[model samples]
Target: MRTASPPRALVIVVVVLAALLGSAYALGRSLVDGVPEAAPSGGPLTAEQPTAPSTGPSASPDPYQQWPAEDGPYGARSTTGDARVALTFDDGPDPYYTPQALAALRAYGVTATFCLVGENAQAHPDLVRAIVADGHTLCNHSWNHDVLLGGRSRQTIQTDLLRTNQAIRAAVPDARIAYFRQPGGAWTYPVVSVSHELGMMPLHWTVDPSDWRAPGAATIAARVTAGTGPGSIVLMHDSGGNRQGTVDALYRILPDLASRFHVTALPPEL
Candidate 1:
């Protein structure tokens, strides 16, 4: 009798399928659950109506539904028919790269989202305001980009979310900052709970260019382009590491993405 062994390619194929399926499950669950419905007397539901949108001219849609928590803390999911999708940068509002990034975005007539780290926001409020003035979404990345999700206290996580919200509110009070992308995409039992406590929607990326690795612009663009699709949230960084590669890739991909698809900012609501 011949001994049987698993084919190497077959194993690889099986692994890829499993990973893809797992991702699909997460995406489906997140979409199906979108944003949780608020209780009758939740924090912002009854009191903070204006910032939230109503369903129709006459009907009141579920508040959570009105502002779907679909934006990957950094911004909204980029989908196929979306004429254009949101282009989001995390850990930024930096002086060096953001100005260049903004210039490119402005030149292309496109918008983006910036998931601001609290300390960075404090350090660069001008850039944050400019981001808002320039028509980009400002989201929370955390006060310190802590690994708080895995082990920190709920109070600490809440502080991270609430403080950043306040900081953004101070700079651009009109900017209805609604999303929270955890540091390293880290989450735990308290992550969503604390997020809910502070009136933010947790966000994560479906595609990450890992531009922080300083992958040359061509490679970065290639990775991102390979992943572009509907309901996809592409992750790039503007700060927390050298980001010239990210800036360069943005210059290349923005025009290409716009040419092939709708490259617009994700709306706060439908």
Candidate 2:
């Protein structure tokens, strides 16, 4: 005899139950695949334990890598690039104080760089010769010590610098004016470019005693001695008013500086 067919409700119920079971198995497999492995000692999963990024050496930036490019001529120089210090006197060759300053330098046997004012150099060619004779370097300090010279037109600046160099050269026919120091340390791009065109290095000082104001000898000596370090270029004035304090301070400064550093003049040639 042929078997009887199952009831329609029973067949429908079986189909619905089979579909529900299939869905549950698929969902269970998906959850298992999605879950991260447990951490050591049955701790929380790695996905649950979020951590910050490491900050090790590889993350740090190199300091010298992004160093800024020089915008003007090289102004920093030290003799032989060692523990050397340079003494520079500006606006010099004064009839009254230049001799005393020179004598002080001579007594200490220390050669120095003298940035001479063009007019002053023109007036005292003898002193200019004396500076060179003493084996010191020569620098041009502009005509009349114009602090505003850097702001003038390029042609005017050039003419002023040329005139200054001419004055310096007139003193000693073969004088090597390898450096140009802007009066008041006011440097402009045009001034720097023109100085380079004239084959002169722009000179800048590291230590400034402000002895130009004739702040007492002791104060000037203190500032000079305290500010100076290895590879330093010191600025002092031998002229531009009563510089008697500077002349006297040299006695204290030279001995102390000589004892601590290799005090020498800047190279006369660039």
Candidate 3:
């Protein structure tokens, strides 16, 4: 098509517009195609499934490390400089046998720690007062004998411990509870932490006589006598089933324990 050529300025303007359009297209292409890259298959941008916290017994801390050292040993008996050992009775304040246990301790001029069940303490406030009157220390043993209490949550453990402490205070308003014993010796961090916050030492026994099994008075006495030593915390039961054997064993065991070790209750503060 032979037609008159356009003006040079017009031609220049057209060329300039075409160049600008091409530059814009290039920028748009770069923006669309030049993102650094997609993250690799396992990169952080990938969606991840959440994991649940462990709730099994295996998740628990080492029994010895669960509690702070200032609070006391978690798995072993408390260390003391003196030649003193603690005689501790659990699940107590029984109307029938507690009196006998108390009498035996008194006769020997020995003091012991009584880890009382909250319900029993509530039921036998007189016995609870009697325990304190006898110069024995007090320990909270939970509302009931919950062997699995260690596996519970912090809030649940706290509630259980607080209720027991409340029950104990209800019995003896001015009682000084020095220790907390997990039922069946099933201590966990949550239980220990709760007890520490509540101003009670987590008590673990060095000697267990298996008195709760009613394994004859002689057997109980033998176990206690054999197991006791300086700084030993001997575990016995005054209630939570037939504890007559325990009461009888105490009479036989105390004379020997008193002579061998300066048997006494755990001090109020320690």
Candidate 4:
């Protein structure tokens, strides 16, 4: 005999229950898979996390940024960008005249910048020390005062500037040579660019008295005082020959310059 089939109502109830169970299973799987995993302990921060802002002192401003940019010969700086006047002496650190210059500066309570030659700095480290000791700014004037330094190859110019800087630092151990002045004011693009690469400002002058010619003290003094105005970088010399006139002229120039304008050395940390 054949077996009897199940009732229709029972079959329908069983089918409905099986369908509900399958739907429930799918919903649960989706819920579990959609959740994101947590980051590991002590791991790097995730995108949702942000770093805190710093609370210490802000970085110092670049002094050169405020300077006026030159049009030709590669952006050399001539002015001090303010009412202050800068007195820069070139080819210096001579044993005889440097002392006199320093004495005059000391007497007037004024400081100036010294653009030194490599050989001179090397030979007279004591004078370099004195320049630093007097709190004057330092500049690299090239090795041996080569007027044709800017016309040479880039590497040659860079090497010469670096060697001069090295000689300067050897004397003071912590000299801050912030400027490079080409000898004879013979500035070129290569020299200026190399100076920037070496972390120095290419310095020029506004007022030149031709004091390097050993002009009489009265003449040097008259020219400097008359030519100088606000933001002037007066070019004078302390070495390269007898600088007695330049030294003596300082006695007259400093008093008048100090009285008229705010005279100061170029910043050592440009």
Candidate 5:
């Protein structure tokens, strides 16, 4: 009654403006509550914890390191508990004598082990092939018969052995060299260890008739026959000098050896 409605339109306008303000305030609150908060500088966004660093030992050095630096193993001189004797000729494949020895061995129907000199084997590849063809085993004798070979560095020793083996395989492509004999039987720990690492048994001699000295044939025969026994590994030479004595000695010794103990080459596997 007093002021009257200044304008009915003005009243309507005020009501609409108030409704708009309320709607805006509600929308702002909804937006603020829905937004995600920023993560702290150094903290993880998710709840899962990180794993800690490991403190365990790293894997052991490759057990198969080439030629162990230090030596602990040694080669075998005689085989164990077998009633067999092995004839091993070294420094061999001589053009003059190895064939003779082979013939004598063939006559007796015997197989033998030849620890061949690298140079000699290379020179007489035919003999190496003959050795394999006759079912004999091969042993690696260092290239030059270096008596102090084992005293050299591991790499040197390894190289010497590998080179000899290479020469052997060059002659008889599939030759199975099962043993390694250091020149002059100068076996050191390094020599033995490296040999075994190379998949060969270390070979030492139980019977050395000193035939390399070119003793008389009768003397060589007597020595070999007297010294040989079950499990004996007799060492002789087919080269490195006149070996007529060795050839003749073999003719005598092999027949007696066959009649007594079972003379044979080394077992194919160690």
Candidate 6:
């Protein structure tokens, strides 16, 4: 139940935009494709400052002994920096509602991540392209809506994930899909391990508004407003159900959150 992409890939004229929300802390580092950053409140390991030159080569071996990525402030480094937050959408590219959601995001000047399903991406590559064009990040959800970790072989899960990656990359060659959100946010240790080895990190949302259940607009707004804080990842949906409520709530929430705080996107833990 998806549309085939036209022979000519749509040339995306993405307008540069994201919702301009407040930031609890300044950006210390950018997002590493798939790796999520530590929230501001938690204690994190940061980079070591340069020490003065010693007599001969410093007594220490390669100081970068640790997997620098998991420790880097920018790449994979973790550090106790400033407070930050990111708004992310899942199960999207809904022909009707996704664009509305994107418009809301654009209106507020906040960038977000769209965890795309393979079939959805194939059906609506233009929207995916627009997400990238507008400067938002693209991440893989799965090839289908199936729970990849459970009731399946490792090869099955890998096939589903990799196929989605290929689909996204084919649609938007520039799409840097380093993040993977398991279907239903469900994942086994093996799934996470394989994902990391595959150059992606598992993503977990800190705040889930549960808009999929069609919660009232006011309630959704309240949850989004309350859940939002430093280093908080908010989860909302644009499809898989009646998303009109989601769209409406997003419009209202944007200005309200903007008046009180900086409605920014997540890329760094700065």
Q: Which candidate number has the best TM-score? A: 4
Candidate 5 lDDT, tens digit per residue, 16-113? 99999998887788788996454556776555655555656764554435453322235345552467899999988788888898899999999999
Off by over 4 Å in 3: 1-67, 70-82
Task: Please identify model 6 stretches exceeding 4 Å from their true place.
Answer: 1-82, 148-151, 268-270
Each prediction's whole-model lDDT (CA): 0.75, 0.86, 0.83, 0.90, 0.84, 0.71
RMSD per model, one decimal: 21.1, 12.9, 12.5, 15.4, 20.1, 29.7
| Better by TM-score, candidate 6 or 3 | 3
List residue ranges in candidate 4 displaced over 4 A: 1-68, 71-73
Instruction: Please give the range of 10 consecutive residues that has the lowest summed lDDT in model 3.
Output: 71-80
lDDT tens readout by residue for model 6, 112-215:
88888899998888888888888887777888777745347768778888899888877897667867777776666556655665677567776788898998
TM-score list, all predictions = 0.68, 0.72, 0.73, 0.74, 0.72, 0.67
Given candidate 2, what's the lDDT at residue 115?
93
Writing each residue's lDDT as its tens digit, candidate 1 over 27-116 gives 778679986444445455544454544556787544434344443432333342343566779888789998988998999999877889
Q: Which one wins by TM-score: 4 or 6? A: 4
- Our tally of clashes for model 1 stands at 9
Q: Clashes in candidate 3: how many?
A: 0
Q: TM-score for candidate 4, please give it.
A: 0.74
Model 2, CA-based lDDT:
0.86
lDDT leaderboard ranking: 4, 2, 5, 3, 1, 6
Q: Which residue runs of candidate 1 sit more than 4 Å off their true CA positions?
A: 1-84
Q: What C-alpha lDDT, on a 0 to 100 scale, does residue 250 get in candidate 2?
A: 96
Pairs that collide in candidate 3 are none
lDDT of 4 at 49: 70
How accurate locally is residue 58 in candidate 1, as Cα lDDT from 0 to 100? 80
Cα lDDT tens digits for candidate 2, 15-118: 99999999888778878899643345657548776665667877776433332223233332322355799999999889999899889999999999999999
